[model samples]
Target: MATLLAGMGVVAVTNAEAAAGCKVVYSVPSQWQGGFTGNVAVTNLGDPVSGWRLTWAFPSGQTVTQAWNATVTTSGSQVTATNASYNANIATNGTVSFGFNGSWTGSNTAPTSFALNGVTCTGGTATTTTTTTTTPPPTDDAMAATAAMQPGWNLGNSLDATGSDETSWGNPRVTAALLDNIRAQGFNSIRIPVTWGQHQGPAPGYTIDPAYMARVKEVVDWALADGFYVMVNIHHDSWQWIANMPADRAGVLARYNAAWTQIATTFRDSSPKLVLESVNEPQFSNSSGAAQNAELLHELNTSFHGIVRRSGGANATRLLVLPTLHTSADQARIDELTTTLTALKDPRIIATVHFYGYWPFSVNVAGGTRFDAVAQKDLTDSFDRVHDSLVAKGIPVIIGEYGLLGFDRHTGTIQQGEKLKFFEFLGHYARAKKITTMLWDNGQHFGRTSFQWSDPELFAQIKSSWTTRSGTASSDQVFSARSSAITDKSLTLNLNGTSFLGLRHGTTDLVRGTDYTVTGDQLTITASAITRLSGSRAYGTNATLSARFSQGVPWRINLITHDTPVLQNATGTTSAFAIPTAFRGDQLATMEAKYADGSNAGPHNWTSYKEFDRAFAPNYTTNVTTLTSDFFAEVADGARVTLTFHYWSGAKVTYHVTRTGTSVTGTTS
Candidate 1:
């Protein structure tokens, strides 16, 4: 956007009679990686204003984290800020001021272009200040603990899932085994969303039932014992009372105060690893529009924070999570929540928001399963806004609940692979920004009864992004081999994992530069210096390609191929293997070429391969690639050459091979 020289500021005077005539000065008082704060002073040159809204677009994907002296909201790069009650009026020659905190990726340049009520701003150059060098505020214990919570998971549908009882939600009774499984899955934190409405006594000193409270405590203890940070919140109370319903406002608060007070007091002696979220998503239907609803939520949060602190013991310093209206990521809601919470000056206060961005795509229940660029942008923009609004302000943010809903509700067919990709990216992005994210598990993706996941692939996706372990997408990846294949030049293999860190051949660890090179998810063996086992020949015969990772079990790809090869000299004879239709666009696994005497069988590296591209050609069923191997010494024809194809974790190849002249022919298996 627009940049102003340091210590330089200008005030432009335009035709005062023009209806939209107004001069605005925009400046950045401070900025840091991923966030910045800006000030805008609007001067009325045309006429006095009773109300106003200033709008502008950020050249980069900058988003408003929080604003003061105005109500702020953003759509993509465009920002809209309306006057607060205190700053609504401006007279000709008079000026009003508003400021905001925003976040940006890559660059934090100020927007050079600006508009006031759709009218282009004129005649003012910006002034920049040297980045602040002030020492940051001392982080409280709660803040530090909250910071430790990255990549969280929710015990959804089991505790807070809709129903009269826990089992009513289609999930088995909560057990220690389940909690152990979660902790073992690399999740260091768990958010237990509990619906306490039904478990509490009636009015006039309404009390939470002791039995239900103990049940909650039992589950909580399991989480703590498993070394997981626990966050227990009052969930689904809004459906019963916690809302903007004027008639029930007093009663709702009474019950809310009583429930939190009791729960807080009971866990007052618990370790600091336990956190208390004020309430689940609070619904607002106040007649006073967004402003009033925000005020109502502000009051609710303030009351909740106060009650918890007053509950005593560890409660005073315990981390507390607060949610905005409906726990929404809307810019207006974030602005309201940030403005309200910042005033509390409580270091332990964490702002909670739920992410289900671009409902049609992220949570599409109408059979939509694609997660393309548009969906990615939705996630990027959502995280950016919250970062600018709260995280930049030193307030830790917790994505209380986030997930791509059932891929196809009617049929069991879900775009599981794509969904796993989304999870991987979400966790990766969240970890980078220091934003803690919890996956919403409701006995759908995971089977509580069997204590197994319906899709282990999906579980692996989230596990690979965890921060507790050295493993993550940014550094290392862990996954089982899907398929193995051998080309003439090098060994080609496909994996369920996206990134490559290191590889091994069975027990022998292979070096990166010397052994293999990785591109995206494919790993290609480089040097032929791999030493063979005692029983194997010079090259790996009947060998397996294993990988070493920072976490999880090492993955191995069995390299096998069936095709007759003509014994050629140094120029190795090419053994052609047909690509399967399902793997037309996918990379092939490692392939092995067997010697006619059964003396040796080594991998053949596929140097050149083609991916199926509909744009490149129509009616293309399979993309064929030629594979080569240096293992070809001398072989006899019609000697019953065997080529066994190994598949990836989720890939299956079907093909039959036949020798034609000098080349081997491959057909659909």
Candidate 2:
């Protein structure tokens, strides 16, 4: 045995000859005015070693600020990086790599000499190698494989649920028939999120329950049998324990690695269609800032890559997906993942992120009631960043989960028409960018027990977006005043490159010249036709017209006849106050509350317009608008508040409400 002094650290090498044959590759992949990112790969060409350390002296005054995949320490200009617990062993001809963010002034040069366990490296010199390969070269094209997995769906809130079992969430236990139905509905891929923290044994081993492992494998096998691209990941564990990496780095990494190791070994021989994702929405708790979070996620990703690649069998070449911090599509997050992917130098790697539309619009808050310019821009900006950053550079991207955030409570939170437009635009844009999108379904969009879509029309639009772009209109609703004679209604059509076929009502096709006429992008329905369709001019939706296109799903147009809704005075406790409302034919769009002195009231006081469902919700079934406890909790005691309700038909009704301790009263005055 020989003791090796490695830059303020010492290691015992049982066989000194084992470190004789070694090669080190040092490269700076990116650099800024005063900072840069460095990568180092050390390959052991001699006998296998249980533990090893690589040390080098930087010619310039360079200091490492952050590192991942290894424990790195610097003294003066000397840098020593020791293998992490999981990556300490190196088989004959095996390589271990680590990366760090460092700062330098003036000249930045690569280190020419490297020492492994006190022995000078002779196999190769430390040079700026553009690409570093830590694992066997990939045998398949991940780009092509991911491209074929277009239009995916996630089995959300199921195995990923934090409950005691799969059925712990509202979603029924996954069945073969459900998967078959998904395939039948035109989904080419399935993302199965599984939580392991609740099913794993104590520390050290962190062994996952055998029963849970078998159950997860059963789903993967079923998905592969159906010829669907499958992706499995450690889901909710991101918050359960993985997020505590900053507080317990060792324990967190151990459990995370153990979970993935088990997953990889179980599916090592499965079909190539099965993809392994390191983690779901990787994030860190009590982290200093975004920089530290990025480093922690990088550590997890690199560790996952090494474990899967070395698992043998199909995993050696299996497509592995890595996510940015919180799986966000922000430019900074994308750039971070870009560095990780470039450092890994693995062609079989794929990038993933989640999109739930714009923040305000996603949750139907802050007056983001429509898919307006702001929402559209958010979608375009996110996709553009992902495309330019990763997809354009030969790397593929998967939107692991995409949907409206409000869908969690109820799809009705977002108006049906706006929701349709959102999905339609998202589908078209994702396809145009050549990125795969997997709809996040938590037993909301698709009814688990009924085996049907909660909103079939929305699903149709999503399905249409996969193959081609669909034409939409400026507005889905054509409002007509119930007290006045009907007049011609016109809607500007967004052709989206396809020609408009015509308009239809049920089985009867309306005559193009007399009933409706399309001139350029404008479609006009004649007044005579409106009168005929809307017989008696009944309140609410009189008729629903379908505007068909040459391709894709047709746009729907609802003819609504409404009057100014009337509000009735009421009295109730602070816990629940339901204001009697005569909706007539109008549909509620949003509500606004303010104090007598013009100060905003309700939960979100920043904006006068409260959230659709959170602050106040209108029950069309009951013909009343209910103010929740959350709303009254924020209101001033004994203060009269003015409430303005806006309707989709351009009707705004004003009412007054005063809360006194536990009691409340509403007046139409």
Candidate 3:
């Protein structure tokens, strides 16, 4: 990247550039081929120019590489740049000025001449600003989101405010000032989840409670002032808004269209920084209730892209996020639809993916075990799965929500150490893979809020770095690490004062697979990745092992031999379950450890236990790391069937499927 420091007054900021009519039109910004900023202008000078185009001849060195908003087609010294489809409707007889921002390794100088519609324009020279702040570039989505920040504390409870006692988040609730903390922490975007229904007036005339919305506006206004990419979406208003969406014969479609129209138009002229996400997690289908819900969400999807595009400005070119049924990680993979977003013509259809492959932990069981080591590889080979698919047909993907949720339910203390480890790992991997991710912190836990951070013991542990918090892998460093047990099968390796997080060899014996036996005293067994994701037990100071099974329960001290390994020292909770509830609907079987507590909570702590169980059913199978189709063997061709819906609502229902190297079409009963 090139940084050119110009003396004062070298850069011009005229009154025309700041005028109300000066709309700051779509002079799109592109990726930084180099780091620098400049000034220039093109005037109409009274003669009306139909459909304006900018052509500047670089002085032998300023060859255009890549540009956005405007596409540049270069042939030698003369570079021709034109407004991409969305920005083609520029007016004539009006002076338009658009500059570029990029990097240059060679000498930085102003382009010698500029031609507007083949006619030479004046004021050809400008200043180039140099910058030294070179932070790691964010994934594409991150850049777009950070670019959309409408600075403000998320109106978490207030937006959905049944007006009960305000359930404030982050007690000095996230305000304008909180933005500094967000930026400092390397976060690039903020998504504001809103509920317009509760704030609507007594009448159904689309007249929302201006005061309630104003509170939200205050936050967006702050974010805009701070210059961050902000996204505001309809969150959790489905019951009263999306779900209860009139399930009629014909009027339903009209209501849906008018609703989004009002929403899109209301925020149309706001600011380029504000991005409108179509909807939140709208549940479409389960085993039951599939038709109406399915039809509504489908129509919503078909309308969102077009609706936001019609909003204009950045909204026209602005990135729109599309969520799927249940916002399922696998559901977002649209394998069955021919046109994932073909109905819309906008170039900025950013397919939205929510992280929390294990949502049971984030919400239902907040403060679960740290999955840093696991959430890491889950990104590798799968990034391009959805984006590439859409891009081929013309679309991109963005990871809008992801966070290491380690706020313990029992203690309410944020599991900072392990959770941050998860974030740091995902952040690095996400950025490297070119996929952006937003942290899902409502400021409730994770050593951020007052109540949680109040504990001195937890605070100190959370403040310290779990793995190196350096945030970047230095050159010559062995980054992009892919670690597996020297063997992927079951085994216990000791840490042996190795400065690593593992068992000590002198302190633990190893198992190779999942067959264990107890012959009076000695324990014997085998092991596998299934066993690896499960819990284990400590046999002695120098030995650790898995628990033996006695009627499907761990018996403690499982010694796995090539032959007959056995388990010893069995202990059981006094109260027993009529039937023990284990991990269900788990496709990958990421992990499992027998956890039971005195409070009668299931498996409070696995501490040292045995046996990870394979889930019997999976809603959908995906590569946990890259989250795409078939991280493993593919589902047989005739084995799958999809159910599509027909609704009066203006939405289209699509199911993502990876049909191998070919295509397959069929229907469900």
TM-score winner among the candidates?
2
- Expressed as tens digits, the lDDT of each residue in 48-128 for candidate 2 is 866788888988988887676578999999999887544565667778777776777897777777888777776775465
Question: Residue 315 in model 1: shift from native, Å?
Answer: 1.0
lDDT of each: 0.61, 0.84, 0.40
TM values, all candidates: 0.52, 0.78, 0.45
Q: Give a tens-digit lDDT track for model 3, residues 619-648.
A: 222211121122112223323322121111
lDDT of 3: 0.40
Better of 1 and 3 by TM-score: 1
- How much is 561 displaced in model 2, in angstroms? 1.5
| Candidate 2 displacement at residue 610 in angstroms | 1.1
- For model 3, state the Cα shift of residue 250 in Å: 6.5
The RMSD (Cα, Å) of candidate 3 is: 23.1
Off by over 4 Å in 2: 1-139
